[model samples]
Target: MALAGCGTINTVMREDGVAARELKSQKTYCQSIPRVYSGVSYNFCRLNGEPNPDGAFDGHLNFVPFVFVDSLISGILDTALLPYTIYRQSADGSIIIR
Candidate 1:
């Protein structure tokens, strides 16, 4: 005796060339923005628990960590400047600039 299966299997095939062509065209037409990792710097300043007179500036910047040798070199060259300024954050998670 042979046993019978409980469910039936169905298969569908697509033969429309116009729908396939349209789908391909639409897929190619959709574009996306390319992701990039550009180095940028954000500067903020605060003084004596108060906002600084100048506003924060944001621009392209190269970030480098300070080490003993670099610090010595910077001191010799007198090119080191105060790096960052502190600012207050608002309730809405935005930086408050004075």
Candidate 2:
């Protein structure tokens, strides 16, 4: 049961590969912008969130915490960077953060 819900963010996003580029783009974009979504980006990258099937199982290790911890970290970061990021912009709160 726990393992089922661990796929929270992943399940919400389309897995047909089309969004890989966007996912990668968002991840890299956030990586350069701030450390707020770094954790979420790391998790997003873990999905090998790309169109290639080559590295599908690359990081096959268990990373279930990405669902919750990343969100928590991003929330804290977003709150801290409210001034710099501005009220209109949120560091990139991944679906898990919602």
Q: Against the true structure, whose lDDT is highest?
A: 2
TM-score of each: 0.15, 0.30
lDDT against the true structure, each candidate: 0.19, 0.37
Where in model 1 is the C-alpha error above 4 Å? Answer: 1-66, 79-98
> Candidate 2 at 66: error in angstroms?
2.4
For every model shown, the clashing-pair count is 2, 0
Q: What value does the lDDT take at residue 26 in candidate 2?
A: 31
Residue 61 of model 2: what lDDT?
A: 27
TM-score, structure 2 vs. true: 0.30
The residue pairs found clashing in candidate 1 are 44-85, 45-85
lDDT of candidate 2 over 25-81, digit per residue (tens): 433322222233343444455444233345232233224454356556545554555
Per-residue accuracy of model 1 over 54-91 as CA lDDT, tens digit each: 43421211112222233343333322221211111121
